[model samples]
Target: MLYNNITELIGNTPILRISPEVHKLKNIELYAKLEFYNPFGSVKDRIAYGMIKEDLKDIKENGKTIIESSSGNTAKALQILAHINGITFKTVTNRIKIPEVKNILRILGTDIEELPGLSECPDPTDPNDPIRFIENMVSQEPHKYYHTAQYSNMKNRDTHYKTTGREIYEDIGTVDYFLGTLGTTGSSRGIIEYLTEKNPHLVKVGIIADKGDTIPGIRNVDEMHEVGIYEKTLYDDIITVNSLEAINGMETLIRQSGVLGGPTSGGAFWGTLKYLEEVDKSLSEKKTAVFVVCDRVEPYISYIQKRRPDFFEVETHKDTIRNLSNEELANVNTISIGEALEWVEENNPLIIDLRGNMAFRTSHIPNSINITDNYFEELIDAGIPFSNNILVMLVCPVGEKSNKFVALMKKKGFDAYSLEGGIVSWRDAGYPMKPLNLKKKEQAVI
Candidate 1:
């Protein structure tokens, strides 16, 4: 039962039968392969190490560094494994929206080169973007770097074929319908090839983000054409899921089954449901559909907060609450950082963090509860009693959102104060802070 290292725990992820509540169908027997259980927390852990392991001796002997152009699951997997193996890792990343994932990359001491251009699938012709930068690095000095070109590398598709594909077939003898999102398309291509050979009747469904919608690690058809690893012919049908639907699926899974997976996983689930809605109920119930839960939810929590805030928003639309007038809401007073710190030292207040979960995860006041809205009142009313005179200090990245929220809470007869200058000021004032991890202390030791 003991392993020498985390890399040994790469594949053979557990598959759980999804609840009918999340699927909203009595017809399809749905199941999800939980890839978040992988050592670095993603399905990509399979290919990240699988693609690079054979080349390690050459890379180390030649004094070359491992490089990849990624910001999501792939980046996380590479950084963790590369560190464990004593390999120098560098990332070509753009503005990564997922704070928790980005924090992990930074914490690993991965050499990060930030691409100013914001496109995930930037034009290959643009020499400044991450993808093109990778091209130049390896093309110019091939020996100085070992690039695991995930998109075109058959190794990526092959690794999944050998591991992910074999595991699913062994676990569920017959998969009538298999669903996976399109990014590198390694997982889908591998599974589809292996399963169809086992059962020619298997229906392969490829999920894609709707046009102009941004779901992490998924691409539309037009955007996917450049990736050589994707197999268009294997898919019997391609389903499109928008950003909101994906988040809803993610939230539904968490609330119903207590399983936390990223939006790409949700996109696959949403696509499966969409597909079920179009098929005959009698036939679907007789079949089994398996979806890959691509990664964990921690990275996308802030994204979910921004896209569909209702999931985390407090129940303030009830009749038990009085409606606040705009005039009274607008004039609520704000408290300075120093004043807020002084109040914190003197009294125990309910600190509500208004920033997105990722931002709050980066740094916040200790013991503060992370919430999207003024739902702290809901908690208080629900019998986690608070004194009428006690303060509800609202913290944000900046003062704007918290100020408006402060105004609304004031009108509703709650003693609320917006921390002026927000968390940015808290750091500027040298106040003690808390992070989602003990990364600060760990970094000091390292």
Candidate 2:
């Protein structure tokens, strides 16, 4: 096939049938929509084009830079498209968890402004949320920037409805079930709308990351709120898959079916089987179902290795938090908000905040030192960085991460306790917080 421009190569992706022997579903025909076949190598290519193509001329004429709040595939696609169209592109986001994804965006000449909060989706409560930050910037200089609000834009959903949904129906007449891992929730919403017209009884299942887990290109329960295009009523069921399960699903697709899909695709595959397994038992006839293979897997090598180090043959410390036993996890020393003030005064423990540097600077527990979670993990991998006799108190946005670290530290014979409910609780309880004064600190250094 010959193409005049790369934009022409955006849609009409091929779908593959999962072997009956592999899925082992008695009455279901499973299909994988190979979205990675698109020119920029992900399902986001469709939306990137959909969001920008109409405004490309106006944006170019006005010399406005195209901007969005993306840290992954959407930013990559938009950057490439912007380059081809002779326009500048910028992305403002929270700390991108995947190193490879960040490096790729940087290499593509994307102007990235990284914030401190770790939520993959927009958080309305967060003052430094990417959407709010972009809105502020656009308000200040509307002529200087063109913000493509992917999270709320109807164009994102409409593009999928016109192309992705139409192509799937043309290939397979009617879809009995549709499974899609939710990121911006655009692709899933678009497909469900179109396919439901073909078969009103179609089951729409939305996939997300489990609470306190990070799966790239999807939102966890806390981050799911405040998304403009997402509606809970659209889905028949919502399934939560963790990083391990997502990787397991990715491996299954790669090994069993030879589909080179990323963790997001793996998550969708995992969630699809979980939901359909129950439906299969009650089904009287064979039904067709489709799930999207969101992207290729090569970019997420570090992500998979971090969660499953055994796969890469990289050994962790014998007492690493990753290897914490259930007993150790259960027995972590925890202090509530009321107890925290008294405990801090009595013990004088070395307080450690595990939130990102940006958040740490905004406001944190007085006398607390900031070591972002990833760096802290690296410190543990080398060996414990603290004295055995010293008392330690760990804190995070919420208590979950800090609790896990406390468990590992306790196993290592350190007097460590996790602050119950974390810094959020401490702030809510009217405890004093010290804000880092950047100007004063810089002047002092000079």
- What is each predicted model's overall lDDT from 0 to 1? 0.75, 0.87
Clashes of each: 1, 0
Runs in model 2 lying further than 4 Å from the true structure: 116-126, 316-327, 438-446
lDDT tens string, model 2, 1-446? 79899899999999999999989999999999999999999999999999989989999999999999998999999999999999999999985888899999989989999986453322222467789899999999999999999999999999999999999999989999999888899999999999999999999999999876788898887778857899889999999988879999999999999999989999999989988999999999989999999999999999898877777898844776656788988999999989899899898998888876666777888778877777787787677777978989988887888888889878778788999988888988999987777766621110
User: Which residue pairs does candidate 1 place in steric collision?
Assistant: 27-285
Candidate 2 local lDDT, residue 265 = 91
Query: lDDT of model 2 at residue 85?
Result: 92
How much is 293 displaced in model 1, in angstroms?
A: 0.5
TM-score of each: 0.68, 0.94
- Model 2 weakest 10-residue run by lDDT: 117-126
Worst 10 residues of 1 by lDDT: 118-127
lDDT leader: 2
lDDT of candidate 1 over 275-343, digit per residue (tens): 876673656246788889988888777667656645787443432222335565568678888787888
- The C-alpha RMSD of each candidate to the native structure, in angstroms, is 12.7, 2.6
